[model samples]
Target chain A: MFGEELKQFQRLGFRHVLLQVLNFASVIASGLMIWKGLGLITNSESPIVVVLSGSMEPAFYRGDLLFLTNPASEKYKTGDITVYKIPGADIPIVHRVLETHDVVKKKSKRSKTALTGTGEQLLLTKGDNNEVDDIELYQGLDWLERKHIVGKVRGFLPYVGYVTIAMNDFPQLKYALLGGLGLLALVQRE
Target chain B: MHNIFSRVNNVSALFSSCMMGLLVAIALSTLLFTADPKGNLNIASVKVFPMKNRRVSARKQDLAFVNFNITADLRPLFNWNTKQLFLYLEAEYANGQGAKNEVVIWDRIVRRKEDAVINVIGKNKYMFRELSSTFKNVPPAHYALKYNVMPHVGALTYGEAGRTLEAVPFPESRERVS
Candidate 1:
């Protein structure tokens, strides 16, 4: 099995392998560029997110793909679905905004620039499937501030992100996929 | 150049591109159906009562109870791409300290088009509490019925269906409910 592949590898000069490697690197670079570009346009750290849990059932299911946008000038409303990450929690949660409190900050010398603008917004979120609000999930905090939120869901696609979830569930699948892709890139002629 | 692997790759590439095109078409079709439906939201009564804070028994808070009637024919929002409709009743008010608040008191999920016509006279399902733990000195609140239309494969849309013509003032907190 190795003899034919080895012979073919020898037949292809070292320059061809270098070219393939460069091609692979450029493909990965373009992917990263697109991701970063989207983040910049949306003003969000993650412009695209996958629903990891079924907390918002009937509207969004597990493995559904969600597009996010975090406009700096806009304030979140009560009905908007938001994807937020608490300080200590590793996984981000997707929930609906149940309440919003725009607290007025006292005018001080340090905060003079923000005096004309709207005050800080404190939000309370709840899952659609849950019976109660998310105050218990705040991790000792009374309310969720704007900083804890990643972005608001704008667009949705169904079940397109299941591949990532499957790969996460089984580590061997990830390795196998990576290895297979790399092998194909190295061995393919065109 | 035309090996089995290359043929399979070409077929899959073509298949995936066609699938992507179809999905894009479906996503774009959501924009064509633009319907704005109006409804009536009537606030029958509003009452505030002092209650013990569930999280901290040592602290006391004021909870507002709202009774309202909603009549809306949301069937126009249920297009082919519409997956579900999330209807919420929110109370918008401002405090003396210039803090603005919007709290959702009741909500319902409409999954089928037949269920989109909503007519209900109900009370608040979720707790409605102020940030300062009391509703004293807070201005009258304006209640509105809003909805979010979730699509199966496209952008989500939101619209307001109804609103209280005049702000409804919260009654003084009574010591007990008879």
Candidate 2:
């Protein structure tokens, strides 16, 4: 049988518990809705990113939050910083453009591979501080095209994402911190 | 009055102890083995053509090109002794029909500073570039570039702590004004 404490609390105010649960559900649903909305509006799988490393130093530091947007109608250009995903890689990278060539137009009609469609293009990228372009990292990929790009870095907030960086660096700390915060939120009068 | 005063002091002590415990937990976590940001600097260029910005009004017979010019500033971050850097390039198409149509345009060792250009041609193309072993043979409708840079031996900041790598994209020029 349930304890008297549980029954008494339930009888005294089940409405408060219901209201809190509803509030939590509403917050989560709203967050998901916003994410989906961003995906649709930007036409990108990820419309936001956190700068994980100092690879883009000065412009973006570690823990900086970046806002991304990749409109289906917009085209990427040289000097533009973009976030793209590799076929098998889980994480995406942000880098600048290096080179590009329209290969579809290069193959002859009689060639083994001939393009009959339109809007064909390829591109290269490199980091701002490294010595060479990112050819080795491509894992035999020659160039990145429109489909691989996740988004483009449009804006960023510095140091605001330190908490995210900390969480990523120490996953246990993240859970502990969350649990502690929840307890505090529950116990606090205000 | 005495009972009320004692109760208030007890509450205050409880609150202060909770605060202290939280602070200690945070401090302990910071000192624990955390995943620090490694100095493994990786730089590469991925093809970005037919993007929203690339506007080409060329016929099937005309010459269409996607030029990618990438540059990197590896001053303090590059460790000459420890890191062995590798580079690669590839091409793909967006439509699933272009499975048999793919190419590895370039792959090489990056011992010096230079620019790499990888071009893909097809009526429809998508490209990608990566730096890990996972992106070896990608599916259709995508292109990619891959590269690996070794960390230089010895402790040397090619520059500052937060400022190490910088990539510069070559200016897009009109080579084939068809």
Candidate 3:
């Protein structure tokens, strides 16, 4: 029972509880800071991503952790794994680059995202396990531009991101986890 | 006091810390296996033809078909941590817009060291078309045989195995196959 915990909490008084709350807040703040710092260093919106689907099999399975980086000056090449989000699609896709076409332009305004070696790049992608190219997944678009791409997959970790997936699938687990952590933080002494 | 709650927490923390350390070690180990194996890549022929789009037959497109030969020894690339090797033949070219392009025409996945020996004659396996649907006015294209090393639990690495001695030019588009 929490009788002993309550007695300890009462003995600690409200100031100690406030101190504990402040400590918890700092812990969360530091976590967010580290995430944002990694984003800045990698030049990606989300430097770490969890594989949500099994489209890319044998290489990346669902629940795997993927590290990504989007170098602004670099151009995508064939066989490079990329995570991209179309305008209307809510979830991003991870696929290997299948084709890249450097289009010739007569006169064009400079785009904010300048790809390497000049001109705009038109890329086509496909999943390693899929039979066809990713043209159908582009949502009526012919090619995937640099803007639609999130980042290129660089490092990988297996099955670690499954915790987040489990939390997402079962709402009760998420609440139970949060509640347990909060109770522990509040009840713990020092 | 190592109560059930504290025991669970401590055990999980140690387990995860050990896992992180192992992952870091595996990631760093790939740095030690630096294999730069070279080979020969020859483009025997390049044939361009005006074709209908696979999806929309009404639209006309230019498709380049290439026949190539590759000879390399990639057994040196397969180390203890190596999971598989993804070998690809890519065509690199630039359009008038000065944009550089790389397209993989053929690819093979080598999962075993015995298959790492690179000696093959192959042709394009996927469609090879430009964004403009034509290769006309496109500069000469260079073909290179590249390989990507995937590890069991580490960073992915890339390297060039072989390249055509001279950039191959995209031949004029033919009306129909003879």
Candidate 4:
């Protein structure tokens, strides 16, 4: 197998190998561009996420794919599932909004806005399977602010995201996959 | 080009594209099911009681207890694409400090269509409290039954099933429940 592939590689010439590398790099770049473009359109840092835990079991399972959107004008309401990231926490949590308090901001001297209007929203979330609200998960904060939230979950696809979890669990598998893909791309003709 | 590797690659590529198209079509089909079910939600009573704070044992917080009745025919919301229904009862009110609040006092999950015909007389499962630690000067709250229809492989949809005709005022704080 090695001898045949080596012979074919030499036949393709150095220019063809360079061209293949360029093609692979462009494919990777376009994937990144699409992801960032989706993030910009949805107003979310990560437009898509994979559920790593079973906190939202029965509704969202581990390995499920979630699509998120954070519209600036919309106010999050109770019963809406939101994906929020607490400061100091490494992983973002997906949960339902248990409560929302839209506090009014004090009027400023320079600004002409009224004082009675809604300001930043304070949220409290809870898992569907949990017995109590997620006060302890706040990581010392009293309530979850709009800035802490990544986005509200808009769409879901079951089990499509398990590949990432599997790769994470087994690092060797990830390296093998990347190496195999790279090797295939480099040796393939036309 | 006529090797086994190319044949496998072509077949898999075609299979994945077909799968993508099917998933997209299924996601789009969820938009066509516009089922708005109506129901009745009545707040039987609301009482506030002073209780010891769980996090801060040194201080006491006023906890509001609400008893409500719900009768809603939510079967229409369960379509072929719907996996589960997340039903919740939320209290919408404004505090004396001009803060708008929406709190979910109780919730249930319906996984089957038969269980969607809801009829229940229940009390608040989660603690309902004001940020100020008291319900003092808080205005009357309007209770509503809202639901989220989670699809098996599509967009999540939400709607209100029922709402109280009038806002229910919070009763005076009692030292203890009778």
Candidate 5:
């Protein structure tokens, strides 16, 4: 009995373990590759965003997935919607630029070297359909600089992000799905 | 034979459980930190009123004027510590070209529970005088007005407080359009 069982054990050992490891590695690699590809194509660290609110109703809705692109040398313009992250804040904002002012002041001879720029780009942003500009939202942060922007929204698909929202809202479903899929994968002998 | 099948089933169960545990960890992380996608703020009302205006005749035989208005009744997102707010108002023209009339509206700051408004003043020729800052020298056309209200080191209650009031155009006949 022992001799026969030892031969059968060979069928269950190294090959099965190696196959599982390879499958997991491939999944991880593909995810990284896609993220890198998106970064290169958009010239932005984050190339996609999901609309988190209804501030832009009638134009965009919640759960909509927005595709973003930011060329390295590009400047923003009026009516362009953008996503920007503020320092010390975990969430990013989505809004439209209403106006831009290029302000240049003659530098005084004494402090000329200390100033960051002779001119400052002052930006005014607002949500479409919002009655007021975004001055209140800036929290006295003054003007939003070009460096604060993450990306500009180019296109959007509605309600497609609901699955992400749902999975977050109810975590049990997420675990159940994973468990079911793993079981299915493991049960197949071939 | 039964023992062999039992062992296979045990291995499968263990694999599934481990996968489920990892998935749960990921989901927990997402929930703990990521911003909620369901958040939204509705703008309900808006109103604007000119605060100051000085109408004068230019030496070149053209009319010139400066006006400031205070906009009021902007409902806020929540009852948090508000730091500051910014606003921009521009005069638009129908032809979208150089019409002598100009209205530059900008807000310095807005406080909590306070009405927001921008001050504007400019002068143009009499023909252009009739042209409103709403746009270049065209009547019945409106100016593009936009604003944003952000939090400054403050907190916004998840879904209850940020509903803004809609903008109601000031009645043309009112003495101070607000």
Candidate 6:
């Protein structure tokens, strides 16, 4: 089984194999470029996110995919589902905006961009399935500011992100997948 | 050119792309299902009192208690794609400093079309308070019944169902209520 492929590899020579490696590397690089570029256009650190918890159940399951966009000029309102990350917390939470207070801050030229048609808005979020609001989850903070939020959820996809979750749960599967793809790329002729 | 590996790869590639196209079409088809349902919402009563918040430091915060009535036939909002409806009551007001606020005092999830015809005499399910932590000099609030339509797949949509005809004013905070 190895003899035929070894002969082909020898025939192709080191320079041809190196060129193939370059082609494979470029393909991966371009994929990353498109993902990061989309994130920039959407103004979300992560343009797409997978639901990892059941807090927002009946609407989003554990592996559902969510699309997000944060329009810098727009203000979040009550009932909009927002994906927010609290400081020191690694995972983001998806919950609905239960309260929005546009508190009047002293008008300073430096903070002008923070003010919308409404004053600087402060938000409180609550999971639909949870019994109470997310005050306890804030970690001593009273309210969630706009900065802590990743984005407002706009579109949803069902269970498409389970592939990533499956890979995460099984490291062996991940390595096997990566190794198989690498071997195939090396062995296959254009 | 016509090897077994290439044939399997071509078939799989075509199959995945077709599935993607079908999903996109289903997501876009929601735009054509234009449904705006209307109903009635009334504020039965509103009372306020100064109370200490124990979760944080012991500081007096004006807590408003509200009782409301809702009668909305939200069946029109449900379709095969609709997973559920998140219904909520929001209080819209402005403080003395002219800062606007919208707060959801109560909410319920309706998972079935049979349960979408809502008729309830309910009270605030969550704590209702102003950002300044006082209802004194806070303007009267307008109550609106809104809904978020969550789909099994595709974009989520929102709409209003009903609103109180008049703004409800918070009564002067009593030191204590018997």
Maximum-DockQ candidate: 1
lDDT of 3: 0.88
Report per-candidate DockQ.
Answer: 0.85, 0.03, 0.64, 0.81, 0.03, 0.84
TM-score of chain A of each: 0.97, 0.81, 0.91, 0.95, 0.78, 0.92
Q: Kindly list the per-residue Cα lDDT of model 1 for residues A164-186, writing each as its tens digit.
A: 99999999999999999998999
Better of 5 and 6 by lDDT: 6
- Estimate, for each residue in B15-131, the C-alpha lDDT of model 6 and write its tens digit: 999999988888888888889999999999999988887864489989999999999999989987888999999999988988889999999999999999999999999889887
lDDT of 4 by residue, A135-180 (tens): 8999888899989989999999999899999999999999999999
Candidate 3 chain A least-lDDT 10 residues? A108-117
Best by TM-score: 1
Report how far residue B127 has shifted in candidate 6, in Å: 0.4
Per-residue lDDT for A4-122 in model 3, tens only? Answer: 87888899999999988988889889999999999999999999999999988877889999999999989788889999999999999999999887665444366534443366678
Q: Which of 2 and 4 is ahead in DockQ?
A: 4
Residue A1's lDDT within candidate 1 is 78
Is 1 or 3 the stronger prediction by DockQ?
1
Candidate 3's error at B62, in angstroms?
1.4
In TM-score terms, candidate 2 sits at 0.47
lDDT of 3 by residue, B85-140 (tens): 88888998877666778888988889899999888898998888887788999899
Give the chain B TM-score achieved by candidate 2: 0.26
Model 6 chain A: weakest 10-residue lDDT segment is: A111-120
Worst 10 residues of 2 chain B by lDDT: B154-163
How do all the candidates rank in terms of TM-score, highest first? 1, 4, 6, 3, 5, 2
State in Å the error of residue B63, model 5: 18
Model 1 ranges off by over 4 Å = none
Which candidate model has the greater DockQ, 3 or 4?
A: 4
A55-78, model 5: which lDDT tens digit per residue? 765456677777788886666655
Report how far residue A71 has shifted in candidate 2, in Å: 1.3
Instruction: For model 1, state the Cα shift of residue B138 in Å.
Output: 0.9
